[model samples]
Target: MVDSPRIAIDAMGGDTGLAVMLAGAEAAYRQDGALRFLLVGDEAAIREALTRHAELAEASEILHAPDRIAGEDKPSQAIRRAKTTSMGLAIDAVKTGRAGAAVSAGNTGALMAMAKLALRTIKGIDRPALAALLPTLGNNDVVMLDLGANTDCDARNLIQFAVMGAAYARSALELAQPRVALLNIGTEELKGTDEVRDAAAMLRQADYLPLQFTGFIEGDRMSRGDVDVIVCDGFSGNVALKTIEGTARFVADLLRRAFTSSLRSKIGFLISRPATELLRHHLDPNNHNGAIFLGLNGLVVKSHGSANANGVANAIRLAARLVRDDLTRRISEDLANFDTHKGPEAVTA
Candidate 1:
């Protein structure tokens, strides 16, 4: 029997609930025997799913959590009710060292609330941010932070995001000099709102990260893969994320219409089938299935609720990789450096 750390999964969180979670855990365990799991949610549902996928019974176990944190629940209220939810229980497991990490395809706000209220954030990490990542240009994916965590932030918060994000980029993405940039209204120093300009100034002086600190990146430039870490307030960051998702859908719909509109266009699409296949693979959500809630005391991954088995499996694989890499320790050490190289705040006229 191969022994490995087990990941705690909130089986009740996603849209498909226990079924998809079970399939994911089973598939992952079969692929990598070293991966064990704890499905934390409604006991009866978990047991039923387990029977349906009985071969993984030994490698996986169920931990009952009677209540659920609804996706619509306010973050503040969810934090108070954290103990009752499966995601909260899973986070508790990680905190107690019973699990290597926690995986949830549930309420994003609730997960953040539970993790912060239960597991706590590392010192110097003012507020934890969600880095929803996907492959960008140059085989590099950008880490955009505060993705619906804290709506308003100060300089120190943005600085912490950079430090943690850089460590993640280095460890996860293998980027030697992950270029960190502030997401702003404009690339020029003078063109953004007061908050963005001030944040940019702070990042320029805050020198804790091993990653290269680039100036500013506009939202339009995000697709160009201009920066490795994109820092912004949660409000702006969430907007950017939704915009990207919407644009991808719009483009795909447009492509389908273009290809099927005429026989000549269909023939051209067939001739270009290889390149099209490559592009589709590159843009597939399943291929980029996990988002890391960084700065938490331990690794916590959130997958889209609509994820199929492959997506859930990918999330577990991501958590396992993060655990083995000792990501939390590395991030802590790097965050400790924030006080070292930080210069006097830039004087803006």
Candidate 2:
């Protein structure tokens, strides 16, 4: 008997299907006493998984969507015609106000298409970007938008991403007026392709420019603590982000190999166990498991495709918190008043 508290999760949408997703729901319920989940997927599979977790079984509600959005199918076509797909059901739960948020790690393209077609945008947002919240140094984090949504973007779309990303930084990261940086090869005005240069000019003339804009953030400065939001086309942002992720994993693996190389190295590892564990946990992608598809009418989180139970649970919890934060409303309000916030007049992006 789930009452007002509910989260819709695509239990059959991930790589491991209902097994991992049920484990995640159990974890989320254990972590937060007030949270309840509305699991969506194949009924038989979900029931069997829940039978293993008594507590979660008692608090969860299962909904059968009857179909799945396969990883290879084209999102546009699949979303449009796959009426009984799990992705559609989970999103429908939010659209009908039956659930607070939706979580999935299935085919991202399918999820995005279904969500937009179902919930639409939140007034000002033209193209909804998939904004991934990356963990930064200190107690803060920055917002990176267009993670893999739209490959081609104009000057206006980039600026919109800046504003939306800044607002997300403010509400999500609690920044006063988040420093928004355009991803570029160099910080100089003369640098970058014509597209980036044109975007820079458009951003410079923006009324919100003085307060939010940070000119350009070069590839080397990505880890710097100065910027709170980085805006770029989906193609560039996704490539740079994936590169960083790959590098982090590579470094961690190299360290692991070194630590286990010999008896002497093993002894040294014993001495540095705590420090090494901290670093390993910090670099683990599962530790930073959840990502937001920002600019939608409601909050949604996409976990990794290969995410395990703990990762899935973490993603559900992340979506629940974001839904509680009123992120959609906050973003809309902030962008609505961009002209009054700071440099040039308001322009569509």
Candidate 3:
């Protein structure tokens, strides 16, 4: 077990700058006083921000990082500055054992590049995938992976994603046997590309694994609460994620427009104000703010750049929970089990 895991925050990474980052850290500290922080950014600015949250001040340490990674910076460019940048140093802390995990609301690509370079992938895994918890109609949230980490993935990558995703579901969602599925064009056995079909064939035969392989899941069925984990290449995963987010926003805006269309509609909205408030809370992206880079040697969480303090806190909470649960070890063990069972070779054949 990780003893007293401390989360390293990239204070200068996001769109909201240091204020939101510090506030988010403070909010997380408030929720879990046992949590400690390593604030990485301009020393003077971070010190000034800490003055507002006495509790966080007591539980935190400041690390001076003279530079910051911009949102538009290329991954290659960002990697070059990893040594001096706040986002880079925060991830580096995890690699060096100074921190258990890193949290940043920075460029997703940069974080992925820096993290993969600094910590490297766990053995038996070729590449790391980005996974996030999305609110679903099911009793629990669904975990989806390869959210733009690797645009093109082969059968092996998808298989690795499923194992990592299952481990994450068990660790983060406390699921006993997560039902896993490949995101495909159709649920039929013969549908989807060759890579997906091959992966499915392998997963279907491997009943010995901890996760439940439920076969292919189409795009339309993603939010239906039938599966616990959805695996796909980054290209498809990113497109699906953006589509879902856009749809949510569209629905929310439509409701707003309808509610104030006329005086009668306004009154109706007020009468149903409580219900709408609940809906708003449920649909709020801030409530589900963290996206994790799985299959890495250390933990690194990516918070939405526009997220508020509450969102940042949620991301931090996720990182802390994963650390407490020993997520990295769990994934490693799962991968080892898969390899021992000859999962890859059996699937390929």
The window of 10 residues in a row where model 2 has the poorest summed lDDT is 340-349
Q: TM-score, each model?
A: 0.90, 0.90, 0.97
- As a whole number from 0 to 100, the lDDT of residue 55 in candidate 3 is 78
**How many backbone clashes does every candidate have?**
0, 3, 0
For model 3, residues 1-349, the per-residue Cα lDDT tens digits are 7656799999998899899988999999888888989999999998988888777889899999999999999999999999899999999999998999999999999999999999999988888999999988889899999999989888889999999999999988999899999999888899989999989988887787899999988888898899999999999999999999999899889989998999999999999999989988988999989999998999999999999999999999999999999999999888878877885564222
Clashing pairs in 2: 156-349, 207-343, 207-344
The parts of candidate 2 lying over 4 Å away from their true place are 1-5, 202-211, 339-346
Best by lDDT: 3
lDDT of 3 at 284: 90
Let me know the TM-score candidate 1 reaches against the reference structure. 0.90
Give the per-residue lDDT digits (tens) of candidate 2, residues 288-331.
78888788887778988998888888788777777776778777
What is the Cα root-mean-square deviation between model 1 and the actual structure? 3.4
Candidate order by lDDT, decreasing, is 3, 1, 2
lDDT of 1 by residue, 184-263 (tens): 87778997777777767776765545878899888888878878888888889999898888999899999999999999
